[model samples]
Target chain A: MNCEQARPLLAAYVDGELDTVRMLEMEGHLPACPACTRAVRELQQLQQSLRQESLYHPAPAALRRNVLAELSAQARPEPKPAFWSWFRLVPALSGAMVVCLAALLAVTLNRPSGHEQLTAEIVSSHIRSLMANHALDVVSTDQHTVKPWFNGRVDFAPPVKDLAAQGFPLIGGRLDYLHHRTVAALVFQRNKHIINVFLWPGSEKNSAPSLDSVRQGFNLIHWNQGGMTCWAISDLNPTELLEFTRDFAL
Target chain B: MEARERLPAFEQTVLPHLDAAHNLARWLAGNDQDAQDVVQEACLRAFKFFGGFRGDNPRAWLLAIVRNTFYTWLRQNRPAIPTVELDDAALEVADPAAAGEALQTRQADAETVRRAIAALPVEFREIIVLREMEAMSYKDIAILADLPIGTVMSRLARARKLLQKQLAREYQTGGPS
Candidate 1:
């Protein structure tokens, strides 16, 4: 690959967007050509500075508040008219409405694999739990306090293990509603990321050996163990999240 | 589904990406206040079309809306600034040490880097921000930017080329902050 052939691909090469074949060809040509090497280094540095610099502008708190308020205001349905409430008392119509609701519930709950809806629910639960004063129902680093805290609140004792020595410290536990049931959410901190581990008794349909998915940039991994279905979701990278699951299960 | 019914899911899948949207909008619209307006308007548009969002990557989906909203606002509100500014001073002989200056001084301040990026043409600026700052893959960027994969790569290359020259000049001259 000479300069003309290589120059067009040089940026892609530096960006690591080149396919393996093209990348290796660039690799072979780069060291031999000083111009391309300089170009490559410059591009790499530009990319580095762009990434490392604090350039990301988070929406202002006021903006966030206003946007949500605007959405809710726009989405808010007007109050139903008085006649609609009176009409609902008609027996046959009310019976049909009940059937319509049941059908809607069935269709909503019986998603293709149940995973899609459940994943969405889990992600929302994770996000909702992160809100201030909602993350923990009982704050404790001791497994004793956290594990038993779920006993009466939820149907089962969620397995609570603190892998603080492994870099995932037990933070606390919260009750989160997901998958049509209230489940115990065990919270842990891995550096800056909060990992939410949700557990409930597994029904026959949703249990799996292990599964991994990425939803809205959050990493989620779930599996069944000891008759309990467990989902661990966080912003942590997959490898560490997998490690977290392994350590938690240990 | 009605907007009221879909709002919760929208908050879950779409709203979480506000920072990403704001970051992109901030770069594209050129100021925080304008960016907020763009975000607010884009999200309202997003809610209007939320029923059609079937993809899994809501961040990318939200970003696409933000970009489109920004362009529409740009068309209506502001006269087009020269999208491409060829730096005539960039004709000076390339400094041999300039490429390495980033490593040496880390040679620019954070503000300098931010200004350098902001100064890039929108075509180049958006690509660099998405690739470097948002950390999106080229494929995702292609989808978000509505460009072919090849275009995404080449534009990124060209953007970096211009940025390199610009930064090198800034460092070598210690150009005005």
Candidate 2:
């Protein structure tokens, strides 16, 4: 039980992983050795700093939701030879589960991209609102009406602008959830296609250009204006969607 | 689906360890954004092969998968990370000059600790995350990291020394004027 022998075991000793014999020998050597004592102290201090750093990053809220949603989707009966006949036996809950999974499959099947998942979430919410036939809480076509409608409903005022002159007219707005908070969902229309613009509070009024993404055959454009994070999603073509954002920001 | 029963069993055993999985992934990925991706990928892999899980020490099982997912993603995305094993050949000696000054700053603040941990090469970095952060036993880390116990022990020692040196370097550069 000397310094060289005890030196290699110091880390294991500190971790309480040493066997009884090695632990006792290390204990015996440490009382006589100042060097080993210092090493032990330094290791302990490092552990303390690490633990106190708040470095334990918890699973983000969205990860939990996405995983659970995915698990439900994963829980499907094995395929029968008569696949068409098997469809009839799927309980009502499982039937809804399939649709839910299908919506996520488009996003989750891709490479693990947080940005992709977020866009998928936005598109999913938009489709859900239309599916549930609850797209707007306050159905007004005026900018004044839609803007004021969000005053008491949400913590911040969503920037609502009328863009009828640009051919993308304001339909209405509603309170919807996204990015872990209640956001302003402003519905608009370009010709026959519907557009859902989701807005939440943002720190910087980014003057940088808007970034656009296409998901599930829908066009999306995101920008930050007036301390609000805004995303406009639509079935319209990308050019029209970009134009729609430009008009709204005007 | 007959296999539908496995989902609940998987969630009960695996989902509760999400925080552990996240913490390990975050430290390995070096940022919140990539860490989320790593965790998601790990969860998928865990779900896919969960029927084989014997179910003891679920956190350790999930953590092993998380570590594997991170390395796989790292190789694919940042092939820059050396694929060869590091063991002793990669063990970096701490800055000799900062050693003395580093000792005085035993109470290195949280931000310094974070920077020090993040600065270690991925080889040393993973050891610290598993041993110090996760509080995993040496044997458990040996299994999770797929290394001999001696290798795990030596690496942990070197990793701590490197971490201390990193903290000391910070102290020397930015110590009180």
lDDT of 1 by residue, B2-36 (tens): 88998998999899999999999999989888999
List candidate 2 stretches off by more than 4 Å: A78-250, B83-101
* Interface RMSD, every prediction, one decimal place: 2.5, 2.3
Fnat of candidates, each listed: 0.59, 0.71
Error of 2 at A93 (Å): 33
lDDT tens digits, residues B75-169, model 2?
89998666546666566675433374465446777777788888787877888888887898888888888999888887777888778777777
* Per-residue C-alpha lDDT of model 1 across residues A1-250, encoded as one tens digit per residue: 8889998787677667789999989999988998788767666666667876477788889988998999998788975667768766689878988999999999877764677889999998888887775999899999999988887898888889999999999999989888889988999999989999999987545444254789999999987777788999999998899899988766
Q: Which regions in candidate 1 have their CA more than 4 angstroms from the true location?
A: A1-4, A29-35, A79-250, B80-107, B175-177
Chain A alone, TM-score for each of the models? 0.54, 0.54
**lDDT of all predictions:** 0.83, 0.82
Clashing pairs in 2: A77-B1
Task: Pick out the ten consecutive residues of candidate 1 chain A with the lowest summed lDDT.
Answer: A203-212
